[model samples]
Target chain A: MSPSDSLAATGEDQLVSLLTQNLPQSARTLHGPGDDCAVLQNHDSSSLTLFKTDCLVAGIHFTMDTDPARVGAKALNRTISDIAAMGGQPSEALVTLALPPDLPLSWPLGLYKGLRNAARRSHTGIAGGETSSLPKGAPPVISIALLGSVAPPHLVLRSTGQPSHIIAVTGRLGGSLAGHHLDFKPRLAEAQWLAAHGPPSAMMDLSDGLAKDLPRLAAASRTGWHLLPDSIRRHRRCSIHQALSDGEDYELLATFPPDLWPDLSAAWRLQFPKVPLTAIGTLTNPDIKSPPLSGGWDHFS
Target chain B: MSPSDSLAATGEDQLVSLLTQNLPQSARTLHGPGDDCAVLQNHDSSSLTLFKTDCLVAGIHFTMDTDPARVGAKALNRTISDIAAMGGQPSEALVTLALPPDLPLSWPLGLYKGLRNAARRSHTGIAGGETSSLPKGAPPVISIALLGSVAPPHLVLRSTGQPSHIIAVTGRLGGSLAGHHLDFKPRLAEAQWLAAHGPPSAMMDLSDGLAKDLPRLAAASRTGWHLLPDSIRRHRRCSIHQALSDGEDYELLATFPPDLWPDLSAAWRLQFPKVPLTAIGTLTNPDIKSPPLSGGWDHFS
Candidate 1:
């Protein structure tokens, strides 16, 4: 097959693998790709540095008509959320912006203001980044790279959960398209609490919906999961399927030992009264066969 | 005046300032924007982490016809150069790519291969990043974020040079558009050597040409510079003016104490026989006035 044909047939996952194939790993790298963030061992050894990058294209993440400040804020939040998913505290961020040459200066100014506000809220200092003009007809793109820190003991990974662990989610999911995607706060505090207390065995942010992301966590942990359809939480306007399949929820999906669920659930409610922590399923044995689950948003698909 | 109109008149630098204005600085941020990289104090006070991001747009950095591998390599190299300029060792990188949905997968595969090759050459690992599809007509964009480390003493800054220091540049300059820009090495080894030896008082990469970048180094150091037109080393095909005004040279511009030039120059030659270190100017007192120098490439202008 032609190179393009072969690449096209394999899709995004295969393409990423092809791109990263055989790349050397630094001795400092503790956890590389296939997770919410790459964790690198710091010279101190007591703390690990978390690195994550998330990009937002105008048409895909927001439209030209979307408030520029919100767009900027979302860009910062997306990466910050990833750090949160890793059960870490964000420390700094670098932003890269690509804009049309003729774009009015106010748009970028407003966008920066939004980014500054979000960074302040998250206590993530905007460090250094680059800005360049795009081709005339191209859409503006904002990409943020975040650096965070996690105490080695408190660090969580999607690959560490064991079968029979109770699967739980923080906050409600689904209906993010109704504007929650733009304004929802990342559950940084909640993740921190989970890491410190029940200390989730595996954790990730639900940017790609439960149906798709759950499978990822399962695959990474070398296990399987079964969602209790009746236990799925949804927005008033959302169906159970939408709760499972719609993305951009920015909530945390975590697994805890079944023995800790009772106390952990109580503590979560006491700590974050406004956000609900619900038990939705259990991680299954790797050998178990389950019916196929609906896939979530895939940029390539 | 309307915000847009005000921003338009102020331009990119002003926009960057306005964007960063009133942003809180974390206690961990030892250095922020306005430099090659942001230096964050690691939890272990002995080592500092360096952060930087640079973006490349299709039409602005290269044309669609440019080799895909070169595009990927350039993206990785650009950020690596920033780390090099800071006299640091790059450890990890995250790459964000935005491409048109219909783009041939082979193009991305080629781009990844190029990125992987460059990362290997620098011994910098490609950690994790995000990829998303752009609007149909939008051009592809690549942005890279690099994490590196520098010993406190070996760390260099563009704002630390003193008046009367000798200004020198590594390698040739100008006419990079002829194809040198895409393929030039990042001078990482040379920078590491300088930091370990005479150690530049201030340093930066010549991505925007001497005329423009020299002023930046001087301004950051709170000084002025006088370049001897005859002393500049340029590409054979480049004119004196082009040598000063053209950008993307990716060479190192460094300032050293006048007393150390003889020893530093001799050592540089002995260490890098193929790369010429040329003394072209001297940093002047901040109050000194010189004729207006030509500005380098400005994204907004």
Candidate 2:
């Protein structure tokens, strides 16, 4: 079979793997391709540049009836969340919009309003963008590339977890489809606090749900996970399975040393009183197989 | 009429005006929107960051018969050309691809290979990207966001031209549709040499043809331009009208002090013996009534 046929047979995961496996790494590239953000050395040696890009398609991410402003807000928020995941400060963004030729002016205007509002809240500037007309019947597509920076000492990555680390998450999970995904604030401040205090060994935003994302962290760290289902916090009316696989939670999942759990929990409560920070699992030896959980989401699936 | 209807009534230019009219500008922003790239302050304090984004839709940028690698290379080259226009060195790029649901894996792989190859030649790294499946029947779209840096003193802007300055362009223009658009290199080296020597008072790439883009530089500089039609360079067998209106030439358009023209031309010939660098016009007083030229490509026209 041709590469195309084999790719179609295998799916999106394989496609992503094939696309990224052999990219040339530059001298300044500290982390490339596999992380939430590509980390690069800034001309200023004090900080590292964080680069990330994400896309939101109208049909897949939201319906036409969804508020245009929320659509805009979610577009920027998704990339902002990635920066937050890296314990970085989002500084600028470039937005690219592809719309059907007949899209109403108000719709795009409202979207920009939402984007501007969210960007202001996050202290990020929308520096530039490109707007184009797609084919007559295509849906609107929004893609944002966000740039950020973090002090090297405060930076976090999913690959740094250890076998004995306790897994903790901030905020409830699941039912993001009920509007939480569009409105949740990126945990930028919380991440900075964690990096300064608890100093997570590993960290990432809960974009694809606990079940799907936990495995990524585990795989990155070359470990496995042992989740205590009862300890997992869920939104009211959501099941453990739903909490584990609904995705788009926009919460923070992190690993802390077992001994630091008490001090970390205390500090988190004091720092973010309304947000719940719960310990739900522990990193384990890779050889220990845990119960299988449903995957959160796959764009091509 | 609804906002959409009114927007359709007013057209793309009006829509662009509405979208950019009141955008919040940050303190670090040196130039925002309205240019080939947005300029921002680098933390290093010695240089400025150049940010630009451009998108290529299948039907708009290329056809199915177009090589997939060329499609990929063109996507990156578009933004690299923007950086070159600003006299900067491209350092990183983030690519976002939206492919048809059943696109052969070979297609996207070929596209990435082209993108990687071009990025390598330009000294840019493919740092990160997002991939998604377009709705059934929708065409492929590729968007790229490029980042670069330039010494503060070497920076160029389209709005900095002065009356009496000579207008010059590097390389031939027009007939890009015949395949030059897909294969042409962004004038990165020529731009750097010009910035270091002639130090253009104003600069921008000729993406939307000379007739259309010259007026942009004129409007931004608050001046008018008097192009000597006989002096304009054209691709082999291309007419003067085609040379003036055919977009996607990807050549550098710049202004230099009339006193420096002889030296600039001599140095340019020595530096790029194969690429033609021709002076075709002079910036004029804004009140001058130069012959009107037709506008170039508009996304929603």
Candidate 3:
């Protein structure tokens, strides 16, 4: 294979799309791939099962010297964030770790402590996990697969946004690597509150920033977006560009009907007074061109 | 931490024990942490859900030059084998990949082809997955998490074996690394047949060779094993030691009541004539001393 055909050149988004296209789907699969979580038909007609998997690799997600507890927390929280994006309640999780043999026992012990604490806080049970040896010089890799459930009527999906829907985000974006990536709580409660009251037309977590993720949501819903640049909320001291491009901001990016925005915003203010819900844009017709966006995190970049 | 306190010094077994101790469990958890798969209560009281996660790391499970297709098959098959051990039917899977950016995109495409073929044959759906980049020079890692289900009456567990139960294994054992490790079919059909006919007292897949895994089955059931060395059925031309320690056999090892052996063997021969079912040992009282057996795969050793 030539250098141009390498994964680096193909990029994460294109590679994932190429690999997952026309993959297997069963009668039980409510929705597969492309969404934040895969939705599966459950025995109970009233709810559906949500399945997702994610990984955190050292040198990419964290350094060897980083606090092991936070590393563990981040690993589980990332997957939980996917569940939260679907307006689901996390039920159980299985973890897998590939570690270099020379790592101290204390590292994994601290990691498990964090994992246990995080699972407890989310009401998710840590069902089981396995550990294996990595190559001599390789860094540790932590992977988690989580199972969650959502009531059929409340399950939100990225492919349901409509033209003219008001686009909004929960909390500030950008500058997540300055410790927020490791510490930000998933918007599980806030999402559940929205689902219980009245779910938005579409919803997803902004892990890869608005520049990349918003486009994905738009593509999935067969719509375009018109961003209000001045309304895009930024983290403390972050610029508008950074707010649009910097990834790892685990905030909810959702769309609501224009008619429901007034009541939804008022109710959200009363429910989660501490977290900011900022309306930043509106969905547009698919033919309407969106402003070019760049600089969001890309793994193979 | 001292060198003696490293994970290599503690061994994989001890390390897993240290990390998984007292993990949180919920009302829906039927079994957690020790079985081949974690069993969770499903909506239908007649059946339960089985969840498991396993990973194949580069340099550990396979080398860079190894066929990407085989690597992909092995990754999914390994986790599917876990569900089969519990007499369950594979349902859906989520795959996560960590790859070095410079690797050719063709590698992942081939891997996905293999994954799709395996899922098709196993009647499993590919729900969804995530991909991330590994550091430069790092090899690729593929991790799979599978969800399966088993009828309540047919559920099998390693912890339920009894003294005097006849221990039998499906097919030959050991020397798997020669070629079988990559191509051996998981005994899903055979296990489900057994469950439908007469469930085993206890069962598990032999991934870490009989010497290690049999002891685990015994330990879990509070029993001991008495092996009939002459009766062990080894792969063609494999020595007794290799048959006992090569690991990655991916065959079912099960314990049955002595009284049911004749009828069960007769029925199994008619059901799966090509597959050999050999009775190799019997469970002994936990306090009884048996011949010391050693040599099995251990990750950190």
Candidate 4:
């Protein structure tokens, strides 16, 4: 579709590319858009700041009747997952709420309770917040802007994968919407451990399922990829397609050099005995023909 | 009103107090909520990072027929004003957009145009952004999270005003919604100037109007205040009541020591001759009686 098409026709990815093209990027922006988080050169000489924002709307991310506390937890956790994807630790967050003025205060208070618990557990400070009234008949929305910190050596990026890299995913996937989406644990400690240990060549979070997210990581790394047949680890009662295409997994997806696999696997098993880390695929040279790929959840399509 | 009351009954300020009370505040949070921005202690001891977020909703901040570009600019500028309020220079921003899937692609592109121009002018980088499709019949929304940097000596807060301090504001107030709200320039340079020379004891932006915002500053500073008779500088064709209560003025409200007013005012004229700095009030002892103050814009009220 052309740029003149509606957003539904253009789709989220293409629309992002079109809108971000020629964006006014400052010299301080070490990495701009297209990554899990934007990396900015802060005053600290050794560390970079990770910046990301995510939003949840009533009737979209959650129903109006959904528990307000869960809604708030999911909103902040979504952004924290992005920080984890970059091997960064969340530092602070700013929350913006848009709701109907007539709504009971308990809704936001409950939302904030969820937010406070999630942030406290993650060691993220709630720095500031703003609230605005939505027009009549509009659904409520919660948007979070998070700042994270990462040492330059520990910073993982989506554009650094190479051919022969083994693609691995953390934990089981699929059927997350049953309840997991509301309370999925962001793989922050695991990602940090991976970065401090073998340090994957490239990494990102599995929010849009392996089918969609894997290809994105591949494209960003300037490589192609092929998933091993029946290699994906699916959740109980979930089909293989669901494992490959269901979104909101909030798990780590990383690529490691083949040589590091043996030791890294042993260490990962020891470090995270309860969490499963599965090798799913390998990055291939961009020039090579890629295997057929299934599409995942798309917001506008 | 009780905390259990509806948002409209509790009002914006009381609701904010309820929601943010006992929030997760990390050790790195040098200054938390109740200010224009949160001051975080960065690794660089010489400087601090400012974090703030603000949002705009269709049918509230602007109508569907309003220029899309202006909407975009306004969204980013509102957050930037918070940064300016802290005497900081904006470094980067993360934008989150929630819109209908059927929206024309040109709408977002135009919005980006406005965001790009405003960011370029302020030397702020658009770091990363996210977009989500709103459910059917949902209004469009834009939220911006901005990061800014301030040197230690230049950092300003809203809780430092003292008795007898001169309450001054930059530029004329009121009548901003007559097209000015959408395109008004944030007083970044002027604020940075004030922070550098005779840095105000307390400072904030006039978002909710002087009548409301002034008392907020006074309360935060643990002081009472009185407006000098006929001292408010109103926009052309605006009544004094409008000047006192019309919100979205987006001007700087600061308290400075009486001793520095002469030299500071003269230097300000040299630095920003086109902008007027009006002395409208004075901080007073908390025990003193305050004249009846009119309330300004309240989202819930």
DockQ of the candidate models in sequence:
0.65, 0.63, 0.70, 0.76
Q: Evaluate model 3: give its TM-score.
A: 0.98
Candidate 1 regions exceeding 4 Å error are A6-10, A287-291, B6-10
Clashing pairs in 4: none
How well does model 4 score by local distance difference test? 0.90
Query: Which is the winner by lDDT between candidate 1 and candidate 2?
Result: 2
| Model 1: per-residue Cα lDDT over A1-301, one tens digit each | 2466633355566666666667667888888888999999876878888999999998888888888998888888888889999889999888888887678777887888888899889888888788887767678899899999999989999999899999999888888888888888888888988889989999999998888888889989999987786787788889988888889999999999999899989888889898989998899998662545767777765
Give the residue spans of candidate 4 off by over 4 A. Answer: A1-4, A287-290, B1-4
Q: State which candidate, 2 or 4, has the greater lDDT.
A: 4
For model 3, residues B1-301, the per-residue Cα lDDT tens digits are 3434888898887888788889998679999999999999987788899999999998888877888888888899999999999999999999999999988988999889889989999999999999989999886778899999999989999999999999999999878878899887899999999877868999999999998888889989999989887788999999888888999999999999999999999999999999999998899999753656777888876
User: Residue B50 of candidate 4: its Cα lDDT?
Assistant: 91
Weakest ten-residue segment in model 1 chain A by summed lDDT? A1-10
How accurately is candidate 3 docked according to DockQ? Answer: 0.70
Q: In the order shown, what is each candidate's alpha-carbon RMSD?
A: 1.8, 1.7, 1.4, 1.4
Worst 10 residues of 3 chain A by lDDT: A1-10
i-RMS for every candidate (Å) is: 2.1, 1.9, 1.8, 1.4
Residue-wise C-alpha lDDT for candidate 2, range A192-275, written one tens digit per residue: 889888799999999878888888888889998888878988999999889998999999999999999998899889999999
lDDT for A256 (candidate 1): 95
lDDT for B197 in candidate 4 is 98
CAPRI category for model 4: medium
Model 4 lDDT, residue A241, Cα: 86
What TM-score is obtained for chain B in each of the predicted models? 0.96, 0.96, 0.97, 0.97
Give per-residue CA lDDT, model 2, range B50-133, as digits (tens): 998889988778887788999999999989999999999999888898876677778888999999999999989898788877
